[model samples]
Target: MTIRMIGRHIREGLKNMWRNGWMSFASVSAVAITLLILGAAMVVALNAEQLSTYVTGELEINVYLNQQVTDAQGQQVAREIDQLSGVKSVQYISKEEGFKRLKKMVGTQYASFMESVNSGNTLPVQLVVKAANPRETTKVAAEILSVPSVHNIQDGENVLGKLFSFLNAVRDVGLAFVIALIITAMFLISNTIRLAIFSRRREIEIMKLVGATNWFIRWPFVWEGILIGVLGAAIPFAIIAYGYQFLYHYSGGAFVALSFPLMKAGLVAHKIGGILFGIGIIIGLWGGIMSVRRFLRI
Candidate 1:
C-alpha cells in the first residue's frame, strides 16, 4: 500500500482510540499486565539456567585408589582417567600428600594423633577428577570404577542432577505461564477493538457494500490494535529497564557470587525490550484482525 494509505489507516486507528477512551484504557491495562508478567518470567528463566550452569561448572569427582595399588599402578590409572572422553583434568595425590592434607584439615589439635596413623594404611592415593561436562560426571566416574586401581567415588554428583531437573522445570513452567497470559491479553485487546468496530458498524457495512476490499476495511482496526499493544508495552519496558539496572548495581547483580551473575542491565534491557515490543506488535496485529473479521463479513 502507498504511504498515504498507511498514514490514513494510522490516523483513523488513533482517532478510534481517542473516541473510545475507556475501552482503550482497559485494553492498554490488560496488555501492560501481560507484558509485566512476561518480563518477570524472562528474568527467572535466564537466571535459573545461569545457576544450573554455574553449579555444573563447579561439580567434580574425587576418585579414590586401592590402598594396595603401586605408584606405577596409580600412574597408569591417572593416564586412563586423563584419556576418558569427558575428563577435563586429573590430579594425582599420593598417600603421603593425602595424610598431610588430612592433618591440615583436622588442624593442630589433631596433628599429633594423625602422625601416628600410618599414611599408607589410613590414606588412599587418589585422583581429583573434573569432567568436561557436568552432566557427564556420573558416567565418567562409573567408567573410572571399572579400571584396575580405582577403589571408590564420592558425593555421587547427586546435587548437580537435582539442580538440573529443578531449573529445567522452572523454565518449562514459566514458558507455559507466559504463553497462557499472552493469549488472555490478546482476547482482552480484541474485545476492546470489537467495541470500537461496533461503534463504527454502519460505516463498515457501507464500505463492504461498496468496492472497498477486505484489506482496506481491515487496515484501520489492525492499526488500532497495534497502537494499543505498543502503548501497553511501554510501561513494562521502563519498569524492567530501571528495575533490572537497580538490582544489578545496588544488589550486586546476582544472588550468588563468582560463578553466577545476573545478566547485565544493558544486555537485559536490550533483549527484554526487543521481546516486549515484538510480543506487543504481534498481539496488536492479531487482535485487530480478529476484531475486524466479523465486520468484514457484512
Candidate 2:
C-alpha cells in the first residue's frame, strides 16, 4: 500500500473508535483486565521458577577420599570429576583445612578443648562437587562415586530425590497454569473485539458492496485493535515493574528470611515488561484479525 493509503487507514481506524465509543471502551477494558491478570500470574510463576533454581543450586555432592589416597591422588580424582559430563566444578579440600573449618563451625569455646585432645585429625580430604544443573546432580554424583580414590559420597540421596520431584511438579503446574491463562486471555480479548466489530457490520457490508477489497476493509479495524491492546497493557506493565521492585526492596532481596532469593528486580523487571508488551501486541493483533475474519466474513 502507498503511504497515503496507510495514513488513510490509520485515520479511519481512529475515527471508528470514536464512532463506536461504548464498544471501543469495552474492548479496551477487556484487554486491560485480561492482560493484568496474565501479567500478575507471570510474575508469580517467574518467581517460583527462580526459587526452584536457587534451592537446587545449593545442593552439592561432597566426595570423601579414602585414607590410603595421597594428596596427588586426591588432585587427580578432582580433575577426573571435573571431566564428567554433568559436573560443573570440583574443588579439593585438604584434611587440615577441613579441620580448621570444623573448628570454626564448632565455635571458640570448644576449639581450645578440641585442640588439646587433637593428636590426630581423622577428617578425610574431600572434593566438593557441583552439578551443571539440579536435575543432573544424581548422574554427576554417581559418576563421582566411580572414582577409585573416592571412599564415600554424601549427597543426601533420598532427600535430594524427593526435593527434585517436588520442584519438578511445582514447575509443571506453574507452566500449565500460565498457558491456560494465556489461552483464556486470547479468547476473551478476541471475543470482546469481535463484539466491537459486529456493531460495524453495516459499514463493512457497504464497503464490500462498493468494491473495497477484504484487505482494505480489514486494515482500519486491525489498527484499532492494535491500538486498544497497546493502551490496555500500559498500566499493568507499569504496575508490575514498580510493584516487583518495591517487593524486592521490602523483602531485602529474599523472601522473609528464606534462603531462596528473588531474581534481581532491575534485571528481570524490564525483561518481563518487554515480554508483557510483546504479548499484548500479539494478542491484540490476533484478536483484530480473528474478529474481522469471523464477524465481517473477510
Question: What's each prediction's clash count?
Answer: 0, 0
lDDT of 2: 0.77
In the range 1-298, model 1's lDDT, one tens digit per residue, is 8999999999999988988999899888888888998887787776777667776777778989888886677888899889988889999987778877878889999776877775335667888899888788888888888877778887447766677788788778877887887888899888888888888988888987887887887888899999999998998999989998998898687674553777788987888899999999899888988877855453
lDDT tens readout by residue for model 2, 30-138: 6676667767767766776786667687878999999777778778878888888988888889877888888888998897787975667777788889888877787
How many Å off is the CA of 245 in candidate 1? 2.5
Q: State the C-alpha lDDT per candidate.
A: 0.83, 0.77
Pick by lDDT: which candidate is best? Answer: 1
Q: What is the RMSD of candidate 2?
A: 5.4
Best by TM-score: 1
Question: CA shift at 285, candidate 2, in angstroms?
Answer: 2.3
Residue 16 accuracy (lDDT) in model 1: 88
